[model samples]
Target: MPPRPRARTYDPAKTRAAVTAQLEHVRDAVRGLGEEQLAAPTRLGDWTVRELVAHLSMAVGAVGRHLERPAPPAPEVTATGWVAATAALGGDIDDDTRSLAASAAPAELLDRAAARFAELLPQAPGDRLLAARVGAMRLDDFLVTRCVELVVHTDDLAAALGTTLPYDRQALATATRLLADALAAKAPGGSVEVRVPPYAVVQCVEGPRHTRGTPPNVVETAPLTWIRLATGRLDWSEAVEEADVTASGERADLAPHLPLLA
Candidate 1:
């Protein structure tokens, strides 16, 4: 693997708070979902609304499950590493999420997951190492991943339900920053500056570096649009075509480097 980039530092308290707030946002929305709505299709290919919610529970619940295991001697993965590693587990994740969704009502599963996560997360230290499938990762780092999960899936859930869902500000910010930083790590360089105003600004893509004044290449977009592009929910070319993203230089085209977290 490429040399691990310096990982971003996250406030453990803020991360935990963001996770809790976002999970509750999903819980509140799903509590009123009827069978018809629960059976609705989501953008995640075959997963229904029920399966997606179950997967969200699993995403949060994984932390507790790993914490219950013996702690690892050292963290084998950084937060950025976790981003690229997730795609490999797609098959297993799909199987487990489907199984869990079938085993209980969506509301009940979400409640239990929320309670379990709340109980275990508060007791665990930020440096505690988790026995994650991708590899051992720190509690704080893993929690940051959970923010991505909650924010991204909450959007998926909202899209499936054809209604807008409230997003926890901290949760959205953390998720956006993490993915933005991941993109920089994936394409390490100082040739391009990507700005997601108010949330993140990262330099990436290898070429002649800029040291002073304005960068030669700059790409700017909103937080949600950035999230969508990074996660493959939105296409880069389409975003540019629709003027959703502003690109001003030759190296500003990020199409080849997008969907960084597939």
Candidate 2:
């Protein structure tokens, strides 16, 4: 892989708030589900709503668990790199998620995990480096990764349950910006401008550069659609066919750079 770009900075406080808020959003939705709903299948291959919820707890719980370990000397991965790296660990994650789901009531599991996360996050230092599967990342960067996890999987839960789970605005914005920046890092150019309204606008792809005026190549979509596209939840052509995304200009085709994170 190409050298990782300089990691983006996130406000420590906002990240902490976002993580908590998004998790609570999922928690509230899960709390109201009946047994039948908990058993409903999700799009994440063989995982049910319960298992998906269990996995979400694991995602947030990771922060506290890592903080309990000895701090690492330095960070081993950039925030953007975490996105692409996750695809390789799918099998392990699936097994662990299933196991956790089977071990506790979904509501109980989520509550305990959320409580622990809430307790630990405030006490942790933002600059402290924690051991991550990818490598050591500062608490803040790791938390931003949590925003991506919470936001993306929350969408998964919503789709499975056939209900809208409201996004915490800061959480959605941070996740959107991180993924958009990841695309720019992956392509490394100013040839294409990708706009996710109200949150992110990034220039990417390698070709003729646009300095000012209307960008020669432009691709735009809503924030949720952009998230789905970046995370591989939505196909580029399918999104375009459904009118969910709009691209204009010869070099604006982003199929080659899309789903920046698997």
Candidate 3:
């Protein structure tokens, strides 16, 4: 894995709106799930639909939970650093998700989470530090990570249900950019240019830096494809083979450093 990269800032107001909007998208869809549908298996290991939805609530509800407590002394990580640190917490996340899943109906869980998040967002200062699961981050930075959480799992839930869910434009864009920045941080260099059209384009993978017209190595894909690739839901070679990802030059093979935050 690569070290954390330079920090990126997000618009605090837009982040708050994006988080709420994306959660609304999820809550609306989860409200219609039957008992059997809640039990459906998802691609995330053994996490069923119920557990996945529970995780979403937990991810958002964390804001109020954090705000209720004393603010941390200082931010320990940025949004990108939070991304780099998430892989090690999988076991704890699973345990907590299962516990939360058993505590309430999916819709209710989301309602309370969404409600509390909305309530707290108005009073909290953007620079206030929350002791997040991985470490402390500003309220705004933490919410940016929440966008990643909501957008990524929205796709997961959609896949399990054999349908598509809408993405809040800002949420999807934030998630795509954060994950793309994480990839660049993990594989630091300018040898390859990764393009997720209309959202992000980052130079990464250590080698000769491109300074002129067209770079030798370039990888291009849709925003969702890039997100799935960064999070390990989509395989690099598989994407290339399926015509979902276009890679040029030898350095474009990113499988070795993939699943950056999964």
- Residue-wise C-alpha lDDT for candidate 3, range 144-208, written one tens digit per residue: 99999999999999999999899999999999999999888888988899999999988899888
Off by over 4 Å in 2: 1-7
- Residue 97, model 2: Cα distance from true site in angstroms: 0.8
Ranking by lDDT: 3, 1, 2
Error of 1 at 168 (Å): 1.0
Write the residue-wise lDDT of candidate 1 on 1-262 in tens digits. Answer: 3333466788889999999999999999999789999999999999999999999999988988898899989889988888999988999999999999999999999899888887887778899999898999989899999999999999899899999999999999999999988898889888889999999898888888888999999999998899999999999999999999999999998888878775
Candidate 1: lDDT of 120?
84
The number of clashing residue pairs in each candidate reads 0, 0, 0
Cα lDDT for residue 12, candidate 1? 87
Please list the C-alpha lDDT of all candidates, in the order they appear.
Answer: 0.90, 0.89, 0.92
lDDT of 2 at 237: 95
Runs in model 1 deviating more than 4 A are 1-6
Can you give the TM-score per candidate against the true fold?
0.97, 0.96, 0.97
Q: Which candidate, 2 or 3, would have the higher TM-score against the true structure?
A: 3
In order of TM-score, best first, we have 3, 1, 2
Evaluated with lDDT, which candidate comes out highest?
3
